[model samples]
Target: MVLGRQRRQIMKILIAIDSFKGSLSSKEAGEAIKSGILRVIPDAEVLISPLADGGEGTVETLVEALGGSLETVRVKGPLFQEAEAHYGILSDSQYSPKDEKLAVMEMSQASGITLVSPEERNPLKTGSYGVGEMILDAYHKGCRRFLIGIGGSATNDGGIGMLSALGFRFSKENGEEISPIGEGLKDLAGIENASVPEGLLQCSFQIACDVENPLYGENGASLIYGFQKGGNKELLSQMDLWMKHYSELVKEYNPAANPEAPGSGAAGGLGFAFRSFLQGELKSGVSLILEETKLSKKMQGADLVITGEGRLDEQSAMGKAPIGVAKLAKTQGIPVIAFAGTVTEGAKACNQAGIDAYFPILREITTLEDAMNKETAKQNLADTVEQAIRLYRLQHKKQ
Candidate 1:
């Protein structure tokens, strides 16, 4: 009797993992997993795509996945100091219309709270002038479509600093321009758009905002987020009152302004600025990223899809990056798996959210610092993926 050997089938796997913050980048994590998949199935086809939730890694992820370039400019920081800010310009035209360019930027690059030290984290003094500079820089580069992440801001100035940078002057009753910071809201009496660039009218902005705080009141920007940005009880109270005044002024300028709108209080009222002044649309970061990357179209012919983030918790089940990927995969009836550095009990919710299975990459007890080390994380992820694929292949063989 002669026995014949069965040939192994090639598997096409698609990966769209978010950056393992403080551990691995999206590209690096994908590559590590790909290495593991190839170890088990040498002939396997694997595609890695960078992913983010429109936060710290959004610009880098989009730039890498879309064949884009990064441009850095010297802009004013939260305290009106010089800071280097970078934005990404997408080279792929499919993401935008003809003769138009898309620029992805994180406001954190310019005026993030992290840019200022604990001692300098005064919401009353910080401003978002650098954010406006970044926009203007991208605009000059012929980018008419802007995707901005408005998280981690250090200012509560209602975006006056940004609007001022774009030539929307704010002045007092005496015709003198205000300081363009949180304190500026106190004396703001008029807004002038005479100096705004004509090209601004042709631009479109999409802001990534997840908060629902209104512009002013108990749940307003000042009262809700001001504490973290260095506001005391007295300062917060004063800032909230000023926010109300500023919102009224804004309503006078544009009657359609809705200070009570969801997300209007985001990024220290930056959401309101974008919506009321720039006519920008506020959207879910995950949804915007998925559409821009066209991940749904890319997953059509894929046999398996893998996604994950740095950590898996209740928040992960709340429509975070990994959940977003899994939900999209489910729409196509594809099997989805996820891996994370650590998995909480709440992560069990992910299984119901479309992830067929989830794995934690830690192979041994380790300190948090050691576990997050890049080299260690890469090796652990590779090992975890290899084992997962082995089990996957065994199940296939049984079928």
Candidate 2:
């Protein structure tokens, strides 16, 4: 073994991560990861690539990895008027002969609930129309496939706005119809028109989700996630009922399906709209990202891999970013450690998912925003790293 003769050989360190929401971007995650690495292994060569799980910061993550520019288009916001939203069109892959390329969109950027203020959060009026607007623009620009992130939505309008943009129409019995907001759905006595764009179905959709909630009735979008989007008790009931009606109406025409299908309620029932109406496929967003970025290859040669998210708990074990990274690391028999904003009940949930250990960066109850005073948090994490590494060295030496 040449283990004793490796001086001057670079110890390769790869920093991959997701954004820490309101505190840092995915790019910032890589920076922090690199900082953590340099603190322990100053001689190691660092490779930084901020990873995204196809939700909130998907566009930025892809742009940074692909070394591309960002573009913003004015689209309908969660509210009524148009707002500028950002997406990235990556440079063509090295193998492709085409001059044009695909554009990555974190649809939440245009249609996310964050756009609505506390004073104006009416789930009845919000819709994914804005996201469709961005998609239509990208389509005109010759993008053939879309990498769309579909988390944190403001509307539970069942993606009526999205279909409308693609030339599908939902109508009422009185011979006229309005837009596809919750309020509009109640008026949706029937769907009179569906002029789906020709060849639009040919374009591929990569939905970044693993949630399996059905589209209507209990355990569906309105009953489960609607309140967070500002559905009142009455409105929650109404939206749930209206979604059922919409489902029943659509199923009559499609015949092969209805709304109770798994993953039909993801992102405020947009999953149903995409999967049923548009013939889109549902997939695990984090896994797709790891594959697209070739993260397994990067993790192969690392001595240790560190990954984290806003929270580490049972949920994290179920297809979260850090777990995805840990699973990949464990496949190569590499040690994986996780740092998180907090550890919830049953931290043991992560044991089987290939997480070697979990570390909560915060010791006391505190606001992550305030505690994120970078200098202090950095020192705290760095100190923890040193202590853990020291303990590891001691145990290994004895063994």
Candidate 3:
């Protein structure tokens, strides 16, 4: 009988891990996995790579994992022009702005809800204006294909902030031009296509999104994720109404349109704004990250690929890093084991998709914070790996 713990190719092993979130960065996660590997097979040639899904720490994760370097830029923040913020961009790798390569950007860098303080959680006036500036910077740097990740945004202004930078205009009554803030949207009567930026129009644009929310109404951005941006019950209805009106305005501008377009509700109707106005393609963030990082190149020669994230469950199979890795590895005839912070109930179903095994590290943990401590998390992870590998050996040891 062949032991399940049989080496992938008699010796070499490659493991890839993503951040445990609030505890480990993807680098830390990879190191912890390596520590676990050392206990079982001391000589396993582990190839560790960090990963991010274009969320909070996407820039740093990509930079470190793919030998991409960091470039710092000062930009506008979500609110208060006096608010100066910094965003990290790829430097050494392919997305370098110096060489006019396409620069990847995630909405969280400029307009993420997490940046806002409790006092600053006013979504009514919050705008994606900073995101617009980032895109403009990329355009000026000669970046043609903008891979924009639309997630964790503070503003529900749709893509108006970005459109403004691209030379699109919203208008109020009496033909007065206006911005696209939610409150301002209430005053929006028409869209004036006069001011599209020459540079932006010449370039290509795409959205990295995992959501499928439509552009307007109940299934739209405002109704779905708006409350997280601090939308009260009243603003919820108001925001939806505003998006509905903008939807009509968008369709009037284009006959082949519906605010109800798939993924239209992403980024507070930013998806619709991008689709209708910027003519951007909406894609899954996981696929885009995988393509850019060229993970396949690293995974090519690996024996076994161990992938992980902060948690593993039904959602992991959707568009998360572990699921993406598992699917690709399975296709390549590689066995994939998933290690995670915690696995929800019914985690066995995780195997039906692509994962060969799932392990959760939360033992005797009461609160999430308790599980998130760095040393604790690392130890728990090591223990989980040790037990799992031992179990694999026990189950398949030849008689």
Give all candidates' CA lDDT scores: 0.92, 0.76, 0.74
- Candidate 3 runs further than 4 Å off: 1-12, 38-45, 71-74, 91-100, 117-120, 189-195, 230-235, 252-257, 361-399
- Output the TM-score of candidate 2: 0.81
Candidate 3 residue-wise lDDT, 1-399, digit = tens:
366556453555567677887898888788888888778877767787667776667766775665643544556666635344333445443544345456667777777787788776776877887777777776676567677788888888877776776677888888887755666788887777677676676666767888889876778788788788888878788878887887788788876666776788888878888888777888877777777666777788666788888887777766677777778787778778889898888667779878888888887947877789898898888888878866654564542
Model 2: colliding residue pairs: none
| Over 4 Å off, model 2 | 1-12, 35-45, 92-100, 189-196, 233-235, 252-256, 310-315, 340-349, 359-371, 375-399
Top candidate when judged by lDDT against the true structure: 1
Instruction: Give the lowest summed-lDDT range of ten residues in model 2.
Output: 91-100
lDDT of candidate 2 at residue 336, scale 0 to 100: 75
Cα lDDT tens digits for candidate 2, 1-399 = 376557435566566666666555666656765666666667777776557778777777778766867888988888767789998876556412255466788878878888998778888889888888888888787777777778888889888887777777788888586676767888886664457666677887777777889997779999888988888888888889888888888887567555877888988889888877766777888887887677888776776677776667898887788788888887888787776666798777887888888777765667766667665555555566556655654664576
lDDT of 2: 0.76
Local accuracy of candidate 1 as per-residue lDDT tens digits, 236-313: 999999999998989999999999999999999999999999999998898889888888988987889999999988
Clashes of each: 0, 0, 4
Which of the two candidates, 1 or 2, achieves a greater lDDT against the reference?
A: 1
Candidate 1 lDDT: 0.92
What's the lDDT for candidate 3? 0.74
Candidate number that wins on TM-score, 1 or 2: 1
